[model samples]
Target chain A: EAGVTQFPSHSVIEKGQTVTLRCDPISGHDNLYWYRRVMGKEIKFLLHFVKESKQDESGMPNNRFLAERTGGTYSTLKVQPAELEDSGVYFCASSQDKQGRGNTIYFGEGSWLTVV
Target chain B: AQSVTQLDSQVPVFEEAPVELRCNYSSSVSVYLFWYVQYPNQGLQLLLKYLSGSTLVKGINGFEAEFNKSQTSFHLRKPSVHISDTAEYFCAVSENPSGTYKYIFGTGTRLKVLA
Candidate 1:
C-alpha cells in the first residue's frame, strides 16, 4: 500500500504571506489528521478529518489557519497572513478505520514551511 | 487531555551497547501509548505500542518498551544498539479507542549511535 504523500516538501515565504500544504493519504483510508512542530517543540495536533467532515479541530493554533478535505480524497491546510511563529514542519497522517484497538496511522514526510 | 514527556532530549551510545530512552505521561483517564521513530528528513513510523495486557511490548528493529502503569512510564530500550538506530524517537499518548485517534506527542529524543 502507498503511504501518505505530501506536496512542495519545502516552502519559504515572508511574513503576512499565505501558504497551503497538501496531503494525499493512503488509499482506502478514511481518517486524516494534520500536525505541526515548531522549533524545539513537540509535534502538536492541528485537526482531524473523518471522511469529508472534520471530526476534531480543537488543536488548531488560531483562526488564521484553515483545513479542508474536499471530496474526502485529499486534504489541504492553509495558513494565511503567516507569522514567523507559524514556521514549522507540518505532518499529515491517516488511518483506515476506528474499529480496531491498535489501528495504525501512517504519516507523511512532512512539509517544512518557513515564514520570514 | 493527556501529555507526554520525553525527559532526555538527546542520547549518544556506541554500537553493541545497551540504551534506554525514558518517557513519562500524565493523564486522568486510561490512554493508549505509542513510540514512533523518524529518520533524518523522513516521516514518523510506528515503533511500538502499549494498549492492554502485556506491559512489555516488542516493536520492530529490535526495540522494545515496557509500560509501567504505576509510574506512568513507557521507556524504550535496546539491548544492543546499532549505527542504523540513529534517529529521533517520539512518545505519544491518545485518549479513547480507535475512534479518537488524536495523539499528543512528546518533545522527542534524538538517539545518536556511534561506531
Candidate 2:
C-alpha cells in the first residue's frame, strides 16, 4: 500500500496570509495525525483524527490553526494570518488505528511552509 | 505528559565502527518508545519500537535499541554502521500502548558516518 502523501511540497506566504496543507493517508487507515517542526525544534503533535471525528486536539498551537478531515480519508491543515514563526515543515501521518496493535505511523514527505 | 531527551546532538563515527545514541524519557505512567530515522529532505521512518515484553528490540538497517526501565533510557546501537547510516535519529515516547499512535519525539541526534 502507498504511504501517507502530502500535497504542495512547499508553500510561501506573507504574514497575515492564509495557507492550507493537505494530507492523504493510506487507504483503509482509520487514524490521521498532524505534526510540525519549527526552527531547530523537535517535531510536535498538533491533532489526531479517527475516521471523520477528531480524537485529540490538545496539541493545536492556537485558534489560527485549523484542521479538517471531512471524509476521514484525507486531512487539511489551514493556518490563517500566518506569522513569521509559522515557517517550518508540517508533517502528516496515518496509522491503522489507536489500539497500538498496528502502532506504526507512516509519514508524508512534509510540506515546507514559509511565512515571511 | 511525556518528554524525550537525546543526550547527544551529534555523533561522528568511522565507517564500520560501533555507535550508540542515547535517549531518555520522563513520564508519570507506563509508556511506549520508538526510534525513527530521517534522511535528508525525507520524512521520518520507523526503525523500531518497544511496547512491552522484550527489553532489547532489533530494528531494520542493522540497528537495535535496549529499553532500560530503571534508567528510563532507550539507546540505539549498531555493531557496524555504514556511510548510508548517516542521518538524523529521533527517540519518541507515547503514553498509549503500541497501537495508540500519538508520539512525542526528542530533539534528535545527527549521526555522521565517516569514511
Candidate 3:
C-alpha cells in the first residue's frame, strides 16, 4: 500500500503571502491528520479529519491557518499572510482505524515551508 | 492533557555498541506509546509501539523499547548499533479514551552512531 503523499515537497514564500500545502492520504484510509514542527521544536498536532468532517482542530495555531477536506480523500492547509514563524515542516498522516488504538499512523515526507 | 519528554537531546555511540534513548510521559489515564525514527530527508517511520500486551516491545530495524507503566517511561534500546542507525528518535503518547487519536510528542533524541 502506498503511504501518505504530500505535494510541493518544499515551498518558499515571502511574508504576507499565501501558501497552500496539499496531502493525499493512503487509499482506503478514513483518518487523516496534519502536524507541524518548527525549528528546534517537537512535532505538534494541527488538526484531524474523519472522512469529510473535521474531528478535531484544537491544534490550529491561529485563524490565519485554514484546513479543508473537500471529499475526505485529500486535505489542504492554507496559510494566509504567512509570517516568519510559520517556517517549518508540515507533515500529513493517515490511519485506517478510527479509534487509533493499536493502529499505525503513516506519515508523509513532509512539506518544508520557508516564509521569508 | 498528556505530554512526552525525551531525556537526551543527542547521543553518540560507536558501531557495534549498545545504546539507549530515554523517554518519559505524563498522563492521568491509560495511553498508547510509540517510538518513531526519522532518517535524513525522510518522513518519520514507526519503530515500535506498546499498546497493552507486553512491557518489552520489539520493532523494525532491530530496535526495541520497554514500557514501564509504573515509572511512566518507554526507553528505546539496541544491542548493537550501526552507522545506519543514526537518526532522530521521537517518543509519542496518545490517550486511550474513546474518540481521540491526538498524539503528544517529545522534543526528540538524536542518535549518532559512529563507525
Q: Per-prediction DockQ, in order?
A: 0.86, 0.74, 0.84
Chain B, per-candidate TM-score? 0.96, 0.95, 0.97
lDDT of each: 0.93, 0.91, 0.93
**Model 1 over residues A1-116: C-alpha lDDT tens digits?**
78999987999999999999999999989999999999889999999999999999999999999999999999999999899999999999999885663766889999999999
Per-residue C-alpha lDDT of model 3 across residues A50-78, encoded as one tens digit per residue: 99799999999999999999988999999
Regions of candidate 3 where Cα sits further than 4 Å from its true position: A98-101
Every prediction's TM-score for the first chain? 0.96, 0.95, 0.95
TM-score for all models, in order of appearance: 0.97, 0.96, 0.97
Better of 1 and 2 by DockQ: 1
Instruction: Flag regions of model 2 displaced more than 4 Å.
Output: A98-102, B97-100
- Please give, for residues B1-115, the per-residue lDDT of candidate 3 as tens digits: 6889998999999999999999999999998899999999999999999989889999998999999999999999999999999999999998876454788999999999998
Clashing residue pairs for model 3:
none
Candidate 1 residue spans exceeding 4 A from truth = none
